[model samples]
Target: MRDLAELDDRVTHCAACPRLVEWRERVAVEKRAAFRDETYWGRPVPGFGPPDAAIAIVGLAPAAHGANRTGRMFTGDRSGDVLYQALHDVGLASQPRSLRIGDGLSLRGTRITAPVRCAPPANKPTPGERDTCRPWLARELLLLRSTVRVVLVLGGFGWQAVLPVLGAAAWRVPSPRPKFGHAARATLPATDGGPDLHLLGCYHVSQQNTFTGRLTPAMLREVLEEAKHLAALA
Candidate 1:
């Protein structure tokens, strides 16, 4: 892809994984009861934010009723509620709520994306599906290689998924791959002699975590603050 826009267009058309393609489409047609009257953007969800983002937030996949319905990563969901609120509190987001696309929500110098663009059944994508979707994330990181300096990965699935893509995008991922943990940090040196990239880990903003106090709004904001500092946007 020549740019993020082109990449995004291609991503939306992707049907590389049969299982994912079927599931996302089926959910779109069936329609959740609360959203029956609304149109579901059953197509693959693309990353959101500017092309030259200084920081990137990576998540596992589109939620079946969230991004799948809104066609924007992390939108229209409880997880998005917590995540965006934290971003707003840290001054990275223009608003605390991401109800849907065109809701006037904006990220200052951050972009949000996912490893799996399609919503998987039960919110779990198989290993094959994750690998099948790797090229898209790899291409996205490559496109943002010039500007993005910090990657805030939510949960272990995204952490694992992004590390390989980072390597492919010219960052030298460390040997004995870094383990995922809330607040974990790793610095990856650019193989092509570019600026070093900082990787920050945070617990996902899923309801399970937020409701159980496993991930608090304060904790999420702290990570965003750290990302801003690392990206020099603070």
Candidate 2:
């Protein structure tokens, strides 16, 4: 637990990617109209939830005006509205919505994180940038490994990013990596006698998916419930 806190502190101070550093700071300064009076977190965001979480959710990156502004993963974002509601419905979350940091929203037996801690421009991180930010994700997974049984990836980006990290942590990768798609599932056996890992895929809860019916509350809830069941948190 102490190690996780230290990791979070380190993540918050990272300036590894010059483009991400400049862009995040720029967005923080040029406040959005709705948040004109509010202060932006601007720094890299860290994973949120208990250290002993059984389920770990991997997202692509912090939303520029969402986690980037609020300093909490998925908070103050439309994606969060869709995600937290499903989690709540499935009994994995304390509330149905995540607004700001300290909004009393909490996860039960689950943690939410991202491969890229910093908010990327256009809500997309380049391949190089994703690789550069991977060490943090790798370390975080290590810290959570003892209890983590299910890894729920939000999109293809997260699916790709997390697989390598899992491999580095000694979780057995399949001969041919599984493809990413909504409701996809892959079981990763342990190489070091640890618990086997269950990897589940779900479409990102971004506005593009949710607003277009590509991902619905029912769909999201199904995935979350499956994750909960697999993690033995149901």
Candidate 3:
């Protein structure tokens, strides 16, 4: 089986979606005004965390100027500010901020990944793009399954994306499907002798949610605390 580092390296070189490849590369060249002088990663963003992590975080996709710019998940962005801070408060993160790659920030017993590796225009990936990216996420989880006991999904998009992957990974998802809501919890039965998995839902820390008070720092921290507790049991 490939290690997390190996999977990450492979994910970085992927150009499966022509539209995503063109868009990511174009953004890298055109550049954002503030980061024009800096180089953009301009490629797929791989999952970030240790291989033995007990908890997994699933997000929608990389922000166009965030992970796509820093070459690290949730780094160099406002959403990251909210997320890393909450993780730190819950004792999952080594630091409260994720500035860029090589920022010395680290996670303990937790891994962060996304359904879509590349940043899509308008922060929204089409259904086809998302479907095309499924294998990467599936492969990532297969490698992490032995250690990952809990999953924290951010936003409805992430919730939807992860459910199917969980089934494919042999976790018995309910037929009706668990609804996606802040603090929603679903426990998937183990199949083929795999470990039982806990799934937790939280609102995405996007600017729209944060700025409008839909998802506050306190709210996020609370959910992380719960996830940590659940992970401990696993």
Worst 10 residues of 1 by lDDT: 164-173
lDDT for each candidate structure: 0.93, 0.94, 0.91
lDDT of 1: 0.93
Tens digit of per-residue lDDT, candidate 1, span 22-90: 999999999999999999999999999999999999999999999999999999999998888889999
**Candidate topping lDDT:** 2
- The sequence of per-residue lDDT tens digits that candidate 3 reaches over residues 1-234 is 377888999999999999899999999999889999999999999999899988999999988789998999998899999899988888899999999888898999999999999999899999999999999999988898888889999999999998999998969999899999999999999896978999999999999999999999999988888888888832
Ranking by lDDT: 2, 1, 3
Per-candidate TM-scores read: 0.98, 0.98, 0.97
Task: Report model 1's TM-score to 2 decimal places.
Answer: 0.98
Q: Which is superior by lDDT, 2 or 3?
A: 2
Which regions in candidate 2 have their CA more than 4 angstroms from the true location?
A: none
lDDT of 2 at 227: 94
RMSD of each: 0.7, 1.0, 1.2
- lDDT, candidate 2, equals 0.94
